[model samples]
Target: MDLAARKYNFIQELSSIDENLLEKLELFLKTNQKDWFDELSIEEQKEIEIGLKQADNNELMTHTEVMNKFKKWH
Candidate 1:
């Protein structure tokens, strides 16, 4: 039938399953595989890397400090 009916039927069938079947279902449900390996662009990736380095060096301040700095920037 429709998507909602199909999903509801799947959930009902899943709930009726034994513990072994549930375990197998759990693996399929928990797995997150994507088609793209590198989702971020080169620039975005570099920005993330730079942020990580800043954090490692303790150059990134606390939340309050960041808020104060952001207000100053404006």
Candidate 2:
């Protein structure tokens, strides 16, 4: 069968699958996919880690606050 037909058949088959099997398929796809974060530079990774830490510490600013702070520059 052609690729489009195969994908359509696979999606149709997915609709009949049980929740446990669906969860397994989801996990399988996630593990098999290439993560974009893995391509980031060390400095970029560290910056993300810092932002995550700040978030965990409740140090995040609201969208309006951030926009207001940077709006002067624009």
Candidate 3:
């Protein structure tokens, strides 16, 4: 089929999906609309890479640790 016909068919098929599946698909598209890392500056990218490395090395804080640290202010 032609590109326009294919797109129309695809939209028709998508319209037949249940509401929950449609919502999930919309959420997935919105979340993945862009590669967030591509929009970051060089320094920000480096900081993210460093944070990821620390996470891989188990050099990260636990949820309880974070809560405890902030408990005083709350």
Candidate 4:
């Protein structure tokens, strides 16, 4: 089938789905999109990249190490 025909068929099939399923589909479509990184500021993006580089270099702290440090303050 042509793209237009396939789109129409898809819409037709989608319309017959249950309301709750349709709502869940809409939520999934909204939340699963790829535009979240574009919403971050340049500085925030740089900070995330730096943290990722640290992780790549195995420079991150473990949960126990972080908790131990935190315990010293209390």
Q: 1-74 in candidate 4: lDDT tens per residue? A: 99999999999999899999999999999998988778999999999999999999999999999999899788
Q: What is the lDDT, from 0 to 100, of the residue 44 in candidate 2?
A: 97
Residue-level lDDT of model 3, residues 1-74, one tens digit each, is 99999999999999899999999999999988888899999999999999999999999998999999999999
> On a 0 to 100 scale, what is the lDDT of residue 72 in model 1?
68
lDDT of 1 by residue, 1-74 (tens): 99999999999898788999898878876785553426888888888889999999989688998898799668
Clash-forming residue pairs, model 3: none
Per-model root-mean-square deviation over C-alphas: 3.7, 5.1, 9.9, 10.9
lDDT of each: 0.84, 0.97, 0.95, 0.94
Clashing pairs in 4: none
Regions of candidate 1 where Cα sits further than 4 Å from its true position: 33-42, 62-74
TM-score of each model, paired residue for residue: 0.64, 0.49, 0.48, 0.53
Model 2, residue 49: distance off in Å is: 0.5
In model 2, which runs have C-alpha deviations exceeding 4 angstroms? Answer: 1-32
How many backbone overlaps does candidate 4 show? 0
lDDT of candidate 4? 0.94
Best by lDDT: 2
Question: What TM-score should be assigned to candidate 4?
Answer: 0.53
* Model 4 ranges with Cα > 4 A deviation: 1-34
Predicted structure 2: lDDT: 0.97
Q: For candidate 1, what is the lDDT? A: 0.84
